[model samples]
Target chain A: MISIHNLTKQFGRLRALDGIEAEFSAGQSIALIGPNGSGKTTLLKCLLGMARPDNGTLQFEGSDLTRSDTYRARIGYMPQIGRYPDNMRIGQLFDMMRDLRGYPENVDEELLDEFGLKAMFDKPLRALSGGTRQKVSAALAFLFRPAVLILDEPTAGLDPLAAEVLKAKILRERNTDRVIIVTSHILSDLDEISTHVLYLMDGKLQFFKDIETLKTETGESRLGLAIANVMRRHANENQASA
Target chain B: MLAKYSSTAAATLPFTGEPDGVTCAEKKARPVAAMLKIAKYVLYDILRNRIVLGYAAFLFVAALTFFNLEGDGSKSLMSLLNIVLIVAPLVSVIFSTIHFYNSYEFIELLVAQPVSRRTILGAEYAGVGGALVAAFLFGIGLPVAVFAPDARGFTLLVVGVLLTLVFVSLAFLAAVLTRDKARGIGLALLLWFCFSILYDGLVLVLLFAFSDYPLEKPTLVLTFLNPVDLSRILMLLQLDVSALMGYTGAVFNEFLGSTLGVALAYGCLALWVLLPMIWAERVFRKKDL
Candidate 1:
C-alpha cells in the first residue's frame, strides 16, 4: 500500500502538487485523470520516489520511499514515451532490462512473437516503428510481475489488438494483490479495468472514489461523460462557495 | 468470484505463469547489469555508427599520410603524438558530448528503471571511454608501437588513456549541467576549444607580454593546471626531448622533472581526473533525472 501525506512540490513559482494526501491500497487500480499541467505526472513521480516533495512524506507499506530504495524493486514504471538506445536490438534491450532487474530469463515471449519482433531481433531500435516501440515498452512493464505497476499513457502508440492485450494484462495482475496506477487520456481504454478514479484539477487531487460510485453519482455509464459531469458539479460548487 | 475469473484472465494476459514462482527476494539484484547492458549496446552502436567510423578513419588516414609525407620516422612519431594529443581530447569531448545529447531518451528510460543514478553514469563513462580508448589504441597506439617501440610508446598509450578520462570527465560535467542538447554541445565545445587552443594561446601571450620578467617559472606553474600541457611535458620528458619542448620543460625540470617531482606531477594529473569525476557524481546525485 502507498500512503502520501501533505505532498507538495513546486518549481519556482509554479506549484505542481499542493499538500496532496492519499492512500492506495493493494489489489486496487486507480486511473489518474487530469488535463495538461494538472500535476498527475508529478504526483506519480513522487510516489515512485523519482521526484522530491518539498513539504510532504510518501510511505510505501509503512516505509518511507523517499529515504530508501527498497521499495523500487517491487514497482515497475513505464513512461509516456519509451526511450531506448537506438543502437540496441529489441531482443537485446529486453534481455538487458531483465538482467538489470535480476529477473530470470523466462520472459513472456508471446508478445515478442505476436508483434513479429522475433524476425526483427537483430534490428536496432531506431529502425522500429512507433507502434513496435510501444509494444516493447509494454512488454518490459509487465514482464517482472511487480507488486506495483505505474504506467503513464500506457497505450499511447499501440494498435487496438496490442492495446487490448496490455489492458487485459493489467487487469489480470491487479486481481492478485497488486496495485496498478495508470495515467492516460483515453478514458474508454481504462473503463473496464479501472476500479477507482482519482480526479485532478489544476494540480490538486479533487477526489478519489470507486468508479461504480462515480457512475451512479453522475448518472453516466461511460467514464468520459461521468468525469465531465463530476467536473461540472465541482465547478458549480466552487462558484457557490466563493 | 474474482478468484475463478482471475485464473481465466491470467491465461489471456501477456505473461501467464503463476506469480507464486518468484518473490522479490527470489530474483537477484543486478543494478549494474542494466548499465552494462546499455554499455554493450553503446559500444556496438557507436562502433557501427558510420559517422564515428568515418571520423576515426579520417583522423587515422590523415595523421598517417601527413606523417608519411612530411617527415622522418622519429619526427613523424613526434608529430603524430602531438597530433593525437591535441586532436584526441577534442574528439573525445565532442564525441562524448554528441553521444550524451543524442542518448537523452535512453537516459530517461534508464532513470525510470529501479537502477541507481551512479550505475548509469559509470556505465556511460565506461562505454564512451572504451570506444575512445579502442580507437586510440588502434589509431595512435598501433602506429607508436610499430615505430617508437620503446618505453616512450607505452608511456604515450598511458597518456592517451589519461587524456581520454580527463575529457570524458569534463564532458560529463557539461552534460549534467544543462538539459538543452544544443546548449550542452555548445558549452562542451567551448570548453574543449578553450582548453586545447585558446588557453594555450593565452598562456603564450602572457609569457610573451611578460618576457622582461621571470614569467617562465610562473608560466610553468600555470601549465601544470592544464592536463594537455602536463601530458605533453611528461611525454617529452619521457622521450628525452625536453630540449625541443623549449624552456617550459626546463622550468618544469627544475621544479618537477626529478623522480619525486615526476611522481607528484603524475599524482596531480590523476587528481584532475578524480576531482571532475567526483563533482559530476555529486551533481548527478542531486539532479532531477
Candidate 2:
C-alpha cells in the first residue's frame, strides 16, 4: 500500500504534479487514466523516486519513500520507454538484474517462456524490435515477484497476442494481495484488467472509484464511455456556470 | 497469506521458491554487491567500444614508434611524457563526457532499479575511471615497460595514471553540470583547452611581466594549478635535464629532491581527481533523473 499527501512538482514554469493526494491499497488493479501531458507519468515517476517532489510526503506502508531506497525493493517498475545498454544481450540484461537483486528465488521467468523470449536471449537489445523489448520489460517487472507493480503503458508496443497475454496475467493477479498500477491511453486495453479507476487531468485527481460504481454513476458500462461522460458533464457545468 | 495472488490452489500454485529467512542475508549484500556489479559491467562495456579500442591501439602504436625512434630510454621517456601529458587527459575527458551523454538511458534504467543515488553515481565514476586507467595501463604501460625498465619508466607510468584519473574526474564534473550533451561536451572541451593550452600561456605572460623579479616560486605555484603542467613538471623532474641547470632548474631539482615535495605533488594530483568527482557526485545525487 502507498499513500501520498499534497505532492507537488514543478519543471521550470510548468507544474507537473500539483498538490495531488491519493492512496493505493493492495488487492486492486488501478487504471490511471489521463489525457496527454496530464501529469500521469510525472506522478508515477514521483512514486518510483525518479522525479523528486518539490513539496509534500510520499509514503509506502506508513514509511516515507524518500527517507530511504529500500522501499523500491518491493515494487517492480516497467518503464514506458525501456532504455538499456544497447550493446548488452537480452540474457545479460536479465542476468545483470538478477545479479543486482540477487533474488533468484523470487524471479518469475514464466513470461520469458510464454513470450518465447528465452529463445532469443542471446540477441542484443539494440537489434531486437520494439515489441520484443516491451516483452523484456514486462518479464522483468514480474521477475522479482514484487508485491507492487508500476507499469507505464504496459502493452503499448506489444502485438495483440502479447498484449492479451500480459492482460491475462494482470487480471489473474487482480484478487491477490498485490497492487498493480497501470497507465495507458488505450481505454479498452485497461478495462479488462483494472478494477479501480483513478482519473487525472492537468495534474489534479478527477476522481477515484471502483469500476462498477464509476460505470453506474455515469450510466455507461464501458470505461471509455463512462470517463467521457464524466468529462462532458464537468465541461457543460463549467460552461453554464460561467 | 502467501497465496493471496495465486489463481490456483495454494499448495499447487507456482511462485517464489526461497522461503523468507534466506532473504535477510541477501538483502544486506545488495548495495555493495550491486554497485560493484554495475561498475564491472560498465568497465566491460566501455573497453569493448570501438572508440576506446581505437584509443588503446593508438597508444600502443605511438608508444612503440616513439621508443623505437628515440632508442635511448631517457629520450623515449621525454617524448612519451609529452604524449601522456596532453593525449591521455584529452582522451579520458572527451571519451568520458561523450560516454555519459550516450548512456543517458542507461542511467535512467539504473535509477529505476532498487539502488540508491549514491551507489549509482559512485559506481559510474569508478567504472569509467577504472576502465580508462586499464586502457592506459595496457596500451601505454606495456610499451613503456618494454622500452624503459628503470625508475624513469615507473615514474612516467605513475604520471600517466594520475593524469588519466584527473581528467576523467573533470569529465564527470562537466557532464553533471549540464543536461544537454552538446553543452556538456563544449564545457569539457573548454576545460581541457584551458588546462592544456591557455594555462601555460598565462604562465608565460606572467613570467614575461615579472622578468625583473625572482618568479621561480610563482611559476612553480602556477604550474600546480593546471594538472597538465603539473604532470609535465613531474616528468621534467624524472628526466633531470642537465642543460637547463639555471636558477629555476636548481630550485625545481632542490625542491623535488626531497620526499615531501614528491608527496605534495601527488597530493595535488589526488586533489584534482577528488574535488571534481565529489562535486559531480553531490550534483548527481540531487538531480531529478
Candidate 3:
C-alpha cells in the first residue's frame, strides 16, 4: 500500500503536483489518467522517489519511500520510453538486468520463450522494432513479479495481439494480491483493465474512485466519455465553490 | 501470533545468503555486478566499434613504427609512457565524461529500478574506467610492457590503471556538476589541462620567479595534488632517472627521500582515487534523476 500526504512538486514557477493526497491499496489496479502536463508522470515519479517533491511525504506501507531502500526493493518500474544501450543484444540486456537484480535463475523465463523472444535473444536491441522493444520492456516488468508494478504507457507501440497478451498478463497478475499503477493516454486500455481511476487535471487530483462509479455518475458507458463528462462537472463544481 | 509474525518477517525479508541478514547485501553487490556488466559491454562495443578500433589500431601501429625507427629505445619508451600518463588520462576523462552525459536516459532508467545511487555511479564509473584501461593496456601499456617488463614495466601498468581512475573520477565529477554536455566536457578538459599542462606551467613560473630560494620542498609538496605529476614522479623514481629531471628530481629526492615517503606518495596517489569518488557518490545520491 502507498500513501501520499500533502505532495507538492514544482518545476521552477510551474506547479507539477499540487499538494495532492491519496492512498493506493494493495491488490488494486489503478489508472492514472490525465491530459499532457497533468502531472500524472510526476505523481508516479514522486511515488518511486525518482522526483523530489517540493513539499510532501510519500510512504510505502509506512516507511518514507523518498529516502528508503525498503520501498524501492518492493517495486518494479517500467518507463514510458525505455532506452537501452544500442549495441547490446536482447539476451545480453536481460542477463545484465538479471545480474543487477541478482535473481536470474529464479525469474520466470516461460513468458520469454512463449512470446518468441527466445528466438530473437541474440538480436541487437537497436535493430529491433518498437513493438519488440515494448515486448522487452513488458518482459522486464513482469519478470520479477514484484510486489508493486508502476508502468508508464504500458501498451504503447504494441501490436494488437501483443497488447492483448500483455493485458491478459496484467489481469492475471491482479487476480493475485499484487498492486499495479499504470498511466496511459489510451482510454480504452485503462477502461478494459483498471479497477480504479485517478483522474488528474492541471496538476490537481480531480477525482479518485472506482471506474464503474465514474461511468455511472457521468451517464456514459465508455471511459473516454465518462472522463470528459466528469471533467466538465468538476469545472462547474469548482466555479460553484468559488 | 508467532506464525503470523514469522510469515510477515519472511515476507519482508529474503534470506540474503550474506552474513549481514540484509536480503539486499547481495543487492548491494548488484551495483558492482551491474558495473561489471556495463564494462563487459563497453569492452565488446569498443573493441567492435569501427571508429574506436580503428583509432586504437592506428595508435598501436604508430607506436610500433616509432619504436622500430627510433635510435634511443629508453628515451622513446619513457616519452611514450609520459605521453600515455598525460594523454591517456585526458582521453579517459573526455571519453568517459561524454559517455556519461550521452547515456543520461539509460542512467535514468537504471535509477528508476531498485538500485542505490552509489551503485549506479560506481557501476558507470567502473564500466568506463574498465574500458579505457583495457584500451590503454592493449593500445599503449602493451608496448610499454614489451619495452620494459621489469619493475619499470609493472609500475607503468599500475600507473596506467591509477591514471585511468584519476581521469574517470574527474569526468564523473564534471558530469555531476554540470548538466550541459558541452560544458561538462569542457570542464573535464579544463581539469585535464590544469593537472596535465597548466599546473606545471604555473609551477615553472613560480620556480623561475624564486630561483634564489630553496623551493624544492614546496615544489615536491605541490606535485602531490596533480595525479599526472604524481604518476610521472612515481614512474621516474622507479626508473632511477630522477637525476635527469634536474631541479624537479632534486626537489623530489630531497623531500621524498625515504622509503616511507615513497610509500606516502603512492598513498596520495591512491587517495586521488578515493577523494573524488566519495564526493561523486554524495553528489549522485542527492542528484535529481
The residue pairs in collision within model 2 are: none
Ten consecutive residues with minimal summed lDDT in candidate 1 chain A? A99-108
Off by more than 4 A, model 3: A69-73, A103-115, A237-242, B1-42, B50-73, B208-214, B238-248
What is every candidate's C-alpha DockQ against the true complex, given to 2 decimals?
Answer: 0.29, 0.42, 0.32
lDDT of each: 0.75, 0.83, 0.76
| Predicted structure with the largest DockQ when compared to the true one | 2
Which is the winner by DockQ between candidate 1 and candidate 2?
2
For model 2, residues A47-124, the per-residue Cα lDDT tens digits are 988988999999888767765565566678999988888889999999887777653564688899999998998999
* Residue pairs of candidate 3 with colliding backbone atoms: none
Off by over 4 Å in 1: A49-55, A67-70, A103-106, A113-123, A216-222, B1-35, B55-74, B208-213, B239-241, B244-248
lDDT of 3 at B101: 82
In the range B56-112, model 2's lDDT, one tens digit per residue, is 888999899998898956787788888898899899999999998877877888887
Clashing pairs in 1: none
What does candidate 3's lDDT look like per residue over A1-242, in tens digits? Answer: 78889999988899999989899888789999988999998888887767778898887767566665434545777778778877779998888666555544457564586578989989998898887888888888777667888899989998888888888888877855677999999999999889999988889887899988988988899999999888788779989999
How high is the TM-score of chain B in model 3? 0.84
Evaluate model 1: give its TM-score.
0.86
- Minimum summed lDDT over a 10-residue window in model 1 chain B is located at B1-10
